[model samples]
Target: MDESYFVGWGTLMLINAVLAQGKNRSGLNWFLLSLLLGPVATFFLALSEKK
Candidate 1:
Protein backbone atom coordinates (compact mmCIF):
# COMPACT_ATOMS: atom_id res chain seq x y z
CA MET A 1 0.00 0.00 0.00
CA ASP A 2 3.04 2.27 -0.41
CA GLU A 3 4.63 3.97 -3.43
CA SER A 4 7.84 1.97 -3.13
CA TYR A 5 5.86 -1.26 -3.29
CA PHE A 6 4.28 -0.32 -6.61
CA VAL A 7 7.59 0.99 -7.91
CA GLY A 8 9.37 -2.25 -7.07
CA TRP A 9 6.61 -4.33 -8.61
CA GLY A 10 6.68 -2.30 -11.81
CA THR A 11 10.44 -2.61 -11.97
CA LEU A 12 10.23 -6.37 -11.59
CA MET A 13 7.60 -6.58 -14.31
CA LEU A 14 9.82 -4.62 -16.69
CA ILE A 15 12.78 -6.85 -15.90
CA ASN A 16 10.69 -9.95 -16.50
CA ALA A 17 9.45 -8.56 -19.80
CA VAL A 18 13.01 -7.91 -20.87
CA LEU A 19 14.11 -11.37 -19.83
CA ALA A 20 11.18 -12.97 -21.65
CA GLN A 21 12.04 -11.07 -24.81
CA GLY A 22 15.60 -12.33 -24.55
CA LYS A 23 14.23 -15.86 -24.44
CA ASN A 24 12.09 -15.35 -27.58
CA ARG A 25 8.91 -15.06 -25.49
CA SER A 26 6.07 -12.56 -25.51
CA GLY A 27 6.94 -9.42 -23.63
CA LEU A 28 3.27 -8.46 -23.05
CA ASN A 29 2.28 -11.92 -21.86
CA TRP A 30 5.29 -12.18 -19.56
CA PHE A 31 4.67 -8.65 -18.33
CA LEU A 32 1.14 -9.60 -17.29
CA LEU A 33 2.29 -12.89 -15.81
CA SER A 34 4.98 -11.08 -13.86
CA LEU A 35 2.24 -8.90 -12.36
CA LEU A 36 0.74 -12.06 -10.88
CA LEU A 37 3.63 -14.50 -10.40
CA GLY A 38 6.44 -11.98 -9.85
CA PRO A 39 9.80 -13.72 -9.33
CA VAL A 40 8.39 -17.14 -10.19
CA ALA A 41 7.75 -15.86 -13.70
CA THR A 42 11.27 -14.46 -13.73
CA PHE A 43 12.70 -17.85 -12.82
CA PHE A 44 10.83 -19.56 -15.64
CA LEU A 45 11.81 -16.82 -18.09
CA ALA A 46 15.43 -17.16 -17.04
CA LEU A 47 15.31 -20.90 -17.66
CA SER A 48 13.62 -20.68 -21.06
CA GLU A 49 15.72 -21.28 -24.18
CA LYS A 50 16.03 -18.84 -27.05
CA LYS A 51 14.34 -19.58 -30.36
Candidate 2:
Protein backbone atom coordinates (compact mmCIF):
# COMPACT_ATOMS: atom_id res chain seq x y z
CA MET A 1 0.00 0.00 0.00
CA ASP A 2 1.13 3.56 -0.72
CA GLU A 3 2.02 5.90 2.15
CA SER A 4 -0.17 8.59 0.58
CA TYR A 5 -3.20 6.42 1.15
CA PHE A 6 -2.52 6.31 4.87
CA VAL A 7 -1.87 10.06 4.89
CA GLY A 8 -5.11 10.72 3.07
CA TRP A 9 -7.03 8.53 5.49
CA GLY A 10 -5.45 10.28 8.45
CA THR A 11 -6.32 13.65 6.97
CA LEU A 12 -9.91 12.57 6.46
CA MET A 13 -10.06 11.43 10.07
CA LEU A 14 -8.92 14.84 11.25
CA ILE A 15 -11.43 16.58 8.99
CA ASN A 16 -14.22 14.37 10.30
CA ALA A 17 -13.19 15.11 13.86
CA VAL A 18 -13.35 18.82 13.17
CA LEU A 19 -16.71 18.49 11.46
CA ALA A 20 -18.04 16.50 14.41
CA GLN A 21 -16.91 19.16 16.83
CA GLY A 22 -18.63 21.78 14.69
CA LYS A 23 -21.82 19.79 15.10
CA ASN A 24 -21.27 19.76 18.90
CA ARG A 25 -20.46 16.04 18.75
CA SER A 26 -17.50 14.15 20.18
CA GLY A 27 -14.45 14.80 18.01
CA LEU A 28 -12.42 11.85 19.28
CA ASN A 29 -15.28 9.46 18.77
CA TRP A 30 -15.86 10.69 15.25
CA PHE A 31 -12.13 10.48 14.53
CA LEU A 32 -12.05 6.84 15.54
CA LEU A 33 -15.24 6.15 13.59
CA SER A 34 -13.70 7.74 10.53
CA LEU A 35 -10.91 5.19 10.68
CA LEU A 36 -13.54 2.49 10.14
CA LEU A 37 -16.24 4.18 8.05
CA GLY A 38 -14.14 6.72 6.14
CA PRO A 39 -16.36 8.88 3.89
CA VAL A 40 -19.48 7.31 5.31
CA ALA A 41 -18.67 8.97 8.59
CA THR A 42 -18.61 12.30 6.74
CA PHE A 43 -22.06 11.60 5.32
CA PHE A 44 -23.40 10.77 8.77
CA LEU A 45 -21.85 13.89 10.20
CA ALA A 46 -23.44 16.00 7.45
CA LEU A 47 -26.87 14.67 8.29
CA SER A 48 -26.49 15.15 12.04
CA GLU A 49 -28.08 18.20 13.61
CA LYS A 50 -25.96 20.63 15.53
CA LYS A 51 -26.50 20.82 19.26
Candidate 3:
Protein backbone atom coordinates (compact mmCIF):
# COMPACT_ATOMS: atom_id res chain seq x y z
CA MET A 1 0.00 0.00 0.00
CA ASP A 2 2.69 2.45 0.94
CA GLU A 3 4.82 1.58 -2.09
CA SER A 4 1.89 1.98 -4.40
CA TYR A 5 1.08 5.33 -2.86
CA PHE A 6 4.63 6.55 -3.38
CA VAL A 7 4.73 5.29 -6.96
CA GLY A 8 1.42 6.95 -7.73
CA TRP A 9 2.50 10.22 -6.21
CA GLY A 10 5.85 10.10 -7.93
CA THR A 11 4.26 9.45 -11.29
CA LEU A 12 1.88 12.34 -10.80
CA MET A 13 4.73 14.65 -9.90
CA LEU A 14 6.65 13.63 -13.00
CA ILE A 15 3.67 14.18 -15.23
CA ASN A 16 3.01 17.51 -13.57
CA ALA A 17 6.59 18.57 -14.15
CA VAL A 18 6.31 17.71 -17.82
CA LEU A 19 3.03 19.54 -18.14
CA ALA A 20 4.45 22.56 -16.37
CA GLN A 21 7.40 23.04 -18.71
CA GLY A 22 5.81 24.89 -21.63
CA LYS A 23 3.58 27.91 -21.01
CA ASN A 24 3.97 29.86 -17.80
CA ARG A 25 0.26 30.22 -16.99
CA SER A 26 -0.70 26.63 -17.71
CA GLY A 27 2.41 25.37 -15.97
CA LEU A 28 1.66 27.32 -12.82
CA ASN A 29 -1.98 26.32 -12.94
CA TRP A 30 -1.15 22.66 -13.39
CA PHE A 31 1.46 22.67 -10.67
CA LEU A 32 -0.91 24.29 -8.22
CA LEU A 33 -3.80 22.05 -9.22
CA SER A 34 -1.61 18.95 -8.99
CA LEU A 35 -0.79 19.80 -5.37
CA LEU A 36 -4.42 20.49 -4.54
CA LEU A 37 -6.03 17.69 -6.55
CA GLY A 38 -3.42 14.93 -7.12
CA PRO A 39 -3.46 12.19 -9.77
CA VAL A 40 -7.10 12.46 -10.78
CA ALA A 41 -6.64 16.17 -11.36
CA THR A 42 -3.53 15.50 -13.39
CA PHE A 43 -5.49 13.09 -15.56
CA PHE A 44 -8.26 15.62 -16.01
CA LEU A 45 -5.83 18.43 -16.89
CA ALA A 46 -4.04 16.20 -19.39
CA LEU A 47 -7.32 15.26 -21.03
CA SER A 48 -8.50 18.85 -21.16
CA GLU A 49 -5.32 19.80 -22.99
CA LYS A 50 -6.45 17.75 -26.00
CA LYS A 51 -9.43 20.01 -26.61
Candidate 4:
Protein backbone atom coordinates (compact mmCIF):
# COMPACT_ATOMS: atom_id res chain seq x y z
CA MET A 1 0.00 0.00 0.00
CA ASP A 2 2.76 2.45 0.84
CA GLU A 3 4.65 1.53 -2.32
CA SER A 4 1.59 2.18 -4.49
CA TYR A 5 1.14 5.50 -2.78
CA PHE A 6 4.66 6.55 -3.70
CA VAL A 7 4.21 5.32 -7.26
CA GLY A 8 1.04 7.34 -7.61
CA TRP A 9 2.76 10.45 -6.23
CA GLY A 10 5.70 10.05 -8.56
CA THR A 11 3.36 9.59 -11.50
CA LEU A 12 1.43 12.68 -10.54
CA MET A 13 4.68 14.66 -10.45
CA LEU A 14 5.56 13.63 -13.98
CA ILE A 15 2.06 14.36 -15.24
CA ASN A 16 2.18 17.78 -13.63
CA ALA A 17 5.50 18.47 -15.32
CA VAL A 18 4.04 17.69 -18.72
CA LEU A 19 0.91 19.64 -18.00
CA ALA A 20 2.93 22.72 -17.00
CA GLN A 21 4.89 22.44 -20.22
CA GLY A 22 1.61 22.45 -22.13
CA LYS A 23 0.89 25.77 -20.45
CA ASN A 24 4.25 27.11 -21.64
CA ARG A 25 5.68 26.93 -18.14
CA SER A 26 8.80 25.24 -16.81
CA GLY A 27 8.46 21.46 -16.56
CA LEU A 28 11.35 20.82 -14.15
CA ASN A 29 10.19 23.60 -11.88
CA TRP A 30 6.64 22.26 -11.83
CA PHE A 31 7.95 18.72 -11.30
CA LEU A 32 9.76 19.81 -8.15
CA LEU A 33 6.83 21.91 -7.02
CA SER A 34 4.47 18.97 -7.50
CA LEU A 35 6.70 16.85 -5.28
CA LEU A 36 5.54 19.08 -2.47
CA LEU A 37 2.10 20.26 -3.66
CA GLY A 38 0.81 17.07 -5.34
CA PRO A 39 -2.86 17.42 -6.38
CA VAL A 40 -2.84 21.12 -5.60
CA ALA A 41 -0.28 21.54 -8.34
CA THR A 42 -2.66 19.80 -10.74
CA PHE A 43 -5.41 22.22 -9.84
CA PHE A 44 -3.14 25.21 -10.40
CA LEU A 45 -1.99 23.83 -13.75
CA ALA A 46 -5.57 23.12 -14.79
CA LEU A 47 -6.64 26.70 -14.18
CA SER A 48 -3.56 28.31 -15.70
CA GLU A 49 -3.78 29.80 -19.19
CA LYS A 50 -1.50 28.52 -21.94
CA LYS A 51 1.23 30.91 -22.92
User: Which one is best on TM-score?
Assistant: 2
After superposition, the stretches of candidate 4 with alpha carbons farther than 4 Å from their true spots are: none
Over 1-51, each residue of candidate 3 has an lDDT whose tens digit, in order, gives 679987877678667866756423366567667776887777776665432
Which is better, 1 or 2, measured by lDDT? Answer: 2
Candidate 2, overall lDDT? 0.97
Question: Candidate 1 — number of clashing residue pairs?
Answer: 0
lDDT of 1 at 50: 93
Q: Residues 1-51, candidate 1, lDDT per residue (tens digit)?
A: 899999999999999998888888899999999999998988888887897
Residue 4 of candidate 2: its Cα lDDT? 100
Deviation from native of the Cα of residue 47 in model 4, angstroms: 0.3
Q: For residues 1-51, could you state the per-residue lDDT of candidate 2 as single tens digits?
A: 999999999999999999999989999999999999999999999999999
Backbone clashes in model 4, listed as residue pairs: none
* TM-score between candidate 4 and the true structure: 0.94
What's model 1's overall lDDT?
A: 0.92
In order, the Cα lDDT scores of the candidates are 0.92, 0.97, 0.67, 0.96
Clashing pairs in 3: none
Off by over 4 Å in 3: 1-11, 20-25
lDDT of 4 at 29: 98
lDDT of 4: 0.96
